[model samples]
Target: MTNATRISATLPPDLAAFLDEYQETHHLSSRSAALAEAVRALRDQNLQEAYQELGEAQRSGQETYPDDNLDGLENE
Candidate 1:
């Protein structure tokens, strides 16, 4: 946490309220921490989906591979 940057953002009322509630419930120091956790969760979800797809392709003998960055095929 030696380096940090500040940015401004706007959110819908519902989303803003959710962040506030999540911060308080999780005992996060700030809404920024809550938002960071949300983003990390999303990244984890995307990775999980990509790995599932890769496993499925392997099981089905599709012989296709996911991209290096795990973006997978766009047309699927």
Candidate 2:
């Protein structure tokens, strides 16, 4: 099943131009595809940062992970 939603967004001229350039440089089928790729990269980067924080917290001997219980993780 495809999970696609349509939405409208307004971008400033410079950003709009950049988006066009990005779209052209990447040879994407459409602006939506370029934006999707950018968003996916941003999401992956954010996840990596969050995971790094979690690992640091675990190694630092911090007592709690508010969003995680550290359950089922074998000792290093």
Candidate 3:
């Protein structure tokens, strides 16, 4: 299975033009691949920020996950 699905999106004309140029410039297989790469990049960025927040909370001696409220949770 390719794990692919077709979805429709409404993009502004300017943004749509930009995506087309970006896809051509990067030689992506398709616009879907370009959008997927953009989504992956954003996902990685969000994960990085979340990890940084966890690290900061740990440094400040704050409970990233409160043990008192956690039920059926394993910390292994």
Evaluate model 2: give its lDDT. Answer: 0.80
Among these predictions, the greatest lDDT belongs to: 1
- Judged by lDDT against the true structure, how good is candidate 1? 0.83
Tens-digit lDDT string for candidate 2 (1-76): 1678997989999998998999999899899998888877887787678788888998999855776544333431
lDDT of 1 at 28: 97
Clashes of 1: 0
Evaluation by TM-score, superior candidate among 1 and 2: 1
Sort by TM-score, top down from the best: 3, 1, 2
Q: Evaluated with TM-score, which candidate comes out highest? A: 3
lDDT of 3 by residue, 1-76 (tens): 1777788999999988988998999999888988888877887787677779878998999978555643222521
Residue 64, candidate 1: how far off, in angstroms? Answer: 3.5
| Backbone clashes in model 1, listed as residue pairs | none
**Cα lDDT for residue 67, model 2?**
69
**How do the predictions measure up, each by TM-score?**
0.77, 0.76, 0.78
Please give the ranking of all candidate structures by lDDT, highest first, separated by commas: 1, 2, 3
